[model samples]
Target chain A: MTTPLISAAERQRIRSGAHSGPTAGLAPGHVQANLAILPADWAGDFLRFCQANPKACPVLAVSEVGDQALPTLGRGIDIRTDVPRYRVYRDGVLTEEPTDIAALWRDDFVSFLIGCSFSFEEALLADGVPVRHIALDRNVPMYETGIACVPAGRFSGNMVVSMRPMTPRDAIRAIQITSRFPSVHGAPVHFGDPAAIGIRDIAAPEHGEAVPIEPGEVPVFWACGVTPQVAIRNARPPIAIAHSPGAMLITDLLNTQLSVL
Target chain B: MTTPLISAAERQRIRSGAHSGPTAGLAPGHVQANLAILPADWAGDFLRFCQANPKACPVLAVSEVGDQALPTLGRGIDIRTDVPRYRVYRDGVLTEEPTDIAALWRDDFVSFLIGCSFSFEEALLADGVPVRHIALDRNVPMYETGIACVPAGRFSGNMVVSMRPMTPRDAIRAIQITSRFPSVHGAPVHFGDPAAIGIRDIAAPEHGEAVPIEPGEVPVFWACGVTPQVAIRNARPPIAIAHSPGAMLITDLLNTQLSVL
Candidate 1:
């Protein structure tokens, strides 16, 4: 009753309609995932898309067709009710933001849990690398780059990246730290001049608030979880669903378990 | 004999005074090392200096006082004769360049073999990261930075770093690749604007030939093995010796063996 401290407990509270906010600081050491649900027909291509663009969309778990339970990520994880918030999209347009997808659940629905930057951000913070957005109490700046993701059947789009401003020294250490967590956006896709990656204005971003870049600090970028969402939107399927921004599924898997090294 | 194909064979040839030139391409997959031999009286401080500034002076192995063999690095490696060429420093001044130090060998001479950048450069090339200096057939540009090395005893000086221009994408990849070889200078110390590290000119370097930094490429800098040499020169021991520039000690250890991961 005093705000669940464990991932399973937090998920249970969310499932019972108690906690319906962002899961940012919940279950501190556990891995939180971005959610995506699609019809079985679109699942194959989405899976291929995740495989092809792993840095942006590292697939953590895929539920069997129509199954609400993701047994691989955590015990008793009901995809329909476990996430704090969800966005129901029809024909690539957001039609509803629901706390539970039980009413919209279809037998053809397939759920995927993809790696999120939160895991690597935890790592960066643990290593004393300042995450400017988090410190400034704002969202990490998100930019759409000219860099295109490898196409998979019906899924393709330019890679979307989240930027963190840091000095060259911290950026180098962040690269090394994140390289160990390949499942969660891995190392940075690019750093320095954003123009090279096709971002015209460093002060402006397509999504999220732009954090201030102090003098002598360069904006380091990592492929973002929004990238897969972008691909899903571009594919324009009849129906799709994803967790509402910042409202991720708290998984039982410890973040340390994701360090490939 | 036909240009001895292995590291041991090459060492034997160098011992016999047959091969006295730079050892850049010879024994491709094996680890080559920069050499520094100091009298036992000055060796303790030098060892401490290497320990304190590992990234700049990664000590591969240190020899017993008065002993000529470095059994740890390679079998039958006679320190006095294994290196292709040697430079004797008298009171921090260059006094002689000799193929073999048999005449100058002293019972109190303690040899230190330091990890060279060649190992990481090989790793970089293998990963398809273009090393501009190598591609342009010039020495990697080295600069004296305002970044100070942690002082040990009488050894203290600003760090010396070697620069290689690479695209951000390639630089990111290079950082990952080189991070695996911690013994060989590990990852880069700095990148981007040279002025941030107190270098006034990018076109002219204090040591080594300056390679052109192409459009979209950032100059990546790594802690160089020359740092210890600079410190040693400042310490001004009565007598010291080192391998002639680029004429390293060819070791039997494979470069891949140095990978910490």
Candidate 2:
């Protein structure tokens, strides 16, 4: 059968185990969001954390407790099934990676769809600024920083950032371009001297493969989607569910619709 | 004698006196610009230079040859005498710093009012971001960079940047804030590592006083208004005039008017 036109409902149907896999390169131009579902008791603090650290945890859509529909992000998106892969966490420890969460869905759970770097990368590419990771066919390098995110209750951690190698001029232009999309990680939180922010080595990335930094290129970093995941780990909600790294909830919303500017 | 409200009309009337000293703190909230008047023969190349290097030469207003009126930028702005002070150049050398240039105004001259940092600094101050130069009561530091500006005709030189020091968090916010005003040096060109950009010493500024960069504060640099002056000197326009450093041409346009978003 020919690959389907990948609408939001179609993706959700696939996520329901009509199919199951990574969501990258799935829906083009539409927003694919990082997902985090948490207990209602811990939801307030996580919301506050997201608010306090907006760059890292840009909220695209938040669903009511126990409600599966994220109407704003997509038409008839069932958060429990729309995401292709789910990582179950219990007391901050990973418990399982499931294809479907229907059996685990709880009345006290609230879902959040955070803006992803994919949207910004799309924007960067459209603007003619090469995103080194996409060009090299690798994941963007991510690092844990010494810079602390403002704490909210039990949810607190330093920002996690994704790095892109580009010339200083391109970096400046990238900053100007990204600032237009505040919902998508905004601008680079820190650049130059990775060790200054506690990253030990430029080539030795903590999360993803490092791309080649051309001569005269600096590593420009943006607050990452993984940051809220860090806060989730810190908050240690009795039970939490997140989309697997690189696996995301495909939303019908256009990326351009998220720009505050 | 009491200071009249100095309507923009009134200010222009007073400035046409050809003997006013400095134009600082005058025409508050309205945009002020750096003047760089060049011979008509060199105007096309200078225009290309400004286009190629927009961050440094944000041309807010330009005048037709020998016409003193910059109708778009201000009400009845005469390129000849409305600016409080003017510097005359001969063979790329400063020949005079005259208050009035009507005596020296040539029929073949084309005037350019480049956007100045005062507009963005005003925006920053209004946003409650403490500008170190304003706080310490000193001029902002300026330095020549190893970063060569994109060459246009005879106009090509290293960029000159103005520096301000801020903590990383504040720097991030400032980058977001300034990116809104593209006409006025939209965003910072460089931050951290003064040496990386070829500054021999951060404390020893080439042009203005160095404000203290406290512990943990990274130096942020913006493409400066002085950049055009450097290019003008390099281009060696036979008959040119510019505003005395820091003494800009205060216009009737509000700073907010320059913001595209």
Candidate 3:
């Protein structure tokens, strides 16, 4: 197995335009965050939404308006160039997928570094809890749940959850392990029957590739980082930018630093 | 509703033979322990069994041989009298149910105060997670599982688990809440499927009354204090003592003090 790059080195590679790919497994112990850059006009509402629905949108760090650097998350980090790729959305529609957002940078832009599942997934793996999606080499299954996010100002949308199949034994351990990292969605929101949460079909996921659930395993669901993206889509801001799916903002903060306990 | 007494006052009543019924809901915030007194020769192995199976038998306090007071648990607490009632067993068969064991106490006896679910259950209720059995005024259903405890010396037996049915939402919260109190069985051992853990029937439990598991609810199982009791029976010690069902030993220690966090 190849050794993973350090968070700063990986961010440096991405900043230099030498690496343009998914950030998964890039930095072994560092936190990789979901990116959401919105206009200053919409940032406050988005912040309120995150505050109201913390499990789904745990805000790790927020950049000052017109600032490109997230000093708290990492040293010398540039929001414009550090992410491997960025998706520019215009009026809630995807306008372009760009390697860098320098050309489209606006003075009113505010960056949000939301806690991603990568942190808690790392915690789960460290505790010997089997994260099925990682083992199967597949994208974690995600579905649009009937549970609605507590609306804040203009943002309103249903929650989107990521699922991992685990036996009840493993699920219990996973819950204890993940509860320590409240910033990374904390413990699971639901498990067992899918219909109970208004997900009609377990095999057919609305967002990511479906993974097989063994006979004795229950599909444990955690609030996904994608929930914020869905809310952004519904809010329909004039201009918004986010890291391309899987191309997260690698931060200097270690996953262990997020543990509330 | 009847006002509950303080821990010390409740224990005083029990010791005075004025309170011989169940100890549940008597001293609300205090930690109530399951009692196990055995001959000094058999105590070492029983302690090992508890250490090996902490999730099922978390030892809160163990007494010195011939000592009746658990000073660490409560002030002026006598194990022989603090408990509401005690069960005397000879050669694995229960022989008597006494209000106090002071008359039966031997100089070679060693008292063990094992954590009971009451501590975590109080936490769960405080956190607004409904404990089904408690709400229904019935005993929490318990079953014998095929999962065997690690044997230490003469003690060996399959684990016994107590079941509490909950919706997936409540189960997730309950797991997080209970995990904080590791001495009180910690988090649940298994959930979702009963057969997965060798439980033949959900409705028919080996011990305690069965409560309804409404639609959308799954049965969550926690490693029970009774696990050591089963081991005690299998060990067939010449003389053994345990707290009568629901008649726990009231401790001065607050339930919140048990939280590892």
For model 3, residues B1-261, the per-residue Cα lDDT tens digits are: 212257889988888889898787888888889889999999999999999989999999999999988889878888888888788889998899999887898999999999999999998998999999899888788899999999999999999999999988899899888988899999899998899899999999887789999998889999988887789889999999998767899888888889987
In candidate 1, position B188 carries an lDDT of 96
Q: lDDT of model 1 at residue B101? A: 90
lDDT (10s digit) by residue, model 1, range A74-152: 8889999999999888888888999998999999999999998999999889889989889977767889899999999
Cα lDDT of model 2 by residue, A159-219, tens digit: 8889998876677778877887889888888766688787888888777678888877778
Ranking by TM-score: 1, 3, 2
Clashing pairs in 3: none
Query: What TM-score should be assigned to candidate 3?
Result: 0.94
Show pairs that collide, candidate 2.
B31-B253, B68-B79
| Runs off by more than 4 Å, candidate 1 | A1-5, A16-18, B1-5
Chain A TM-score of each candidate structure, as shown: 0.95, 0.93, 0.95
Candidate 2, residue A23: CA error in Å?
2.9
Least well predicted 10-residue stretch by lDDT in candidate 1 chain A: A1-10
Enumerate residue pairs that collide in model 1: none
lDDT at A142, model 2: 86
Provide a comma-separated list of chain B TM-scores, one per candidate.
0.94, 0.92, 0.96
| Docking quality (DockQ) for each candidate | 0.91, 0.45, 0.86
